[model samples]
Target: MGTATGSSFDTETLRRGVEGTTGNTLLSLYADDAQIRIIDRNTQPSHPKVLRGRGEIAAMLDDVYSRDMTHKLDRCVVQGDHAAYCESCEYGDGTRVLAESMITLRDGKIAEQILIQAWDE
Candidate 1:
């Protein structure tokens, strides 16, 4: 995590949030009006799954974080008011999921996020 002043996106905070999502404590890292877009094979580019606002985002993420799996943040980069990261997770059944996300920040919180993910079928 890099340190920078006068920027809403804090690398340390983002790192903590990603690591804490499994603990269900990452909601604090998002703004009340944050939005999230998910794109994958099921949810194609033509029909992406979109979550609006903190409440919706939180609900969706809560379900994800509650899953029985182990999460790892493989890579992360923060620049200006934007941040990006790649994460991988493995479930007990040997299924694995890989996700890459781009986040936009506002007022030190996550305002919007776009994620593309793939999973073992």
Candidate 2:
């Protein structure tokens, strides 16, 4: 991982990064050493699945963004290096989510992110 210098986490930056990627902007933002892990409770054996490496995560998001449309975020709360947010997003076909996310920062860059998503009817 290459060292990242002069990165800062503010409401605007986080919002832009998330909205850009989730709102059909096709833009990606990641820490040089960022890793995303997910566990779906609905699936069998709920173990963490690591989306290893920054580049892979970015590419995965690219595939996601290509098929997704608008994302709307609301009810955001942030303090220090942690944030919790809620989102209403629409994706391909008719897929949509009312999701909540917890975000953590390390050295002013996104270090960890976890999301809990529920399908909206």
Candidate 3:
């Protein structure tokens, strides 16, 4: 395994990753840790789900991609090893949102991801 630099969380890197994510992009290609946890606090109970590993994460992305969703990265801001991004996306089922997220990286890999939904209808 290649050593990850802490700076991998730079704004540009994160922007590229978020913008570069297409329907064909696999989630495994992004997260490889077994402890990867993604939390969407917008829910009542604070839905916290674990992706397990890269493979499962990849599968999740694949499922989304299979729906032919379109994602647009709007803005990205970074400070130190943390990055925040805003994205406007439209899913195949017509679910659209302008979401913002904060990503933290450790050892050059995504350690935790927190997302909030902000849709402008």
TM-scores for candidates 1 onward, in order: 0.87, 0.71, 0.65
Off by over 4 Å in 1: 2-5, 21-23
Could you give me the TM-score of model 3 versus the true structure? 0.65
- lDDT per residue as tens, model 3, 9-115: 44454445455645333242254663444544445225556666667766766665555567777986656555567888787778786767676656655655666
- Model 2 whole-model lDDT (C-alpha atoms): 0.62
The backbone clash count of each candidate, in order, is 0, 0, 2
Give the clash count for model 1. Answer: 0
Per-candidate Cα lDDT values, in order, are: 0.79, 0.62, 0.57
**What is the descending lDDT order?**
1, 2, 3
Candidate 1 has an lDDT of 0.79
- Candidate 2, residues 1-121, lDDT tens digits: the string is 2122344455565566557755223223456677766545553236665666577677767775666576666767766776677877787677776867776767666667776666755
Q: Comparing candidate 1 with candidate 3, which one achieves the higher lDDT?
A: 1
- The candidates, ranked best first by TM-score, are 1, 2, 3
Candidate No. with top TM-score: 1
Find the 10 residues in a row with the least total lDDT in model 2.
21-30
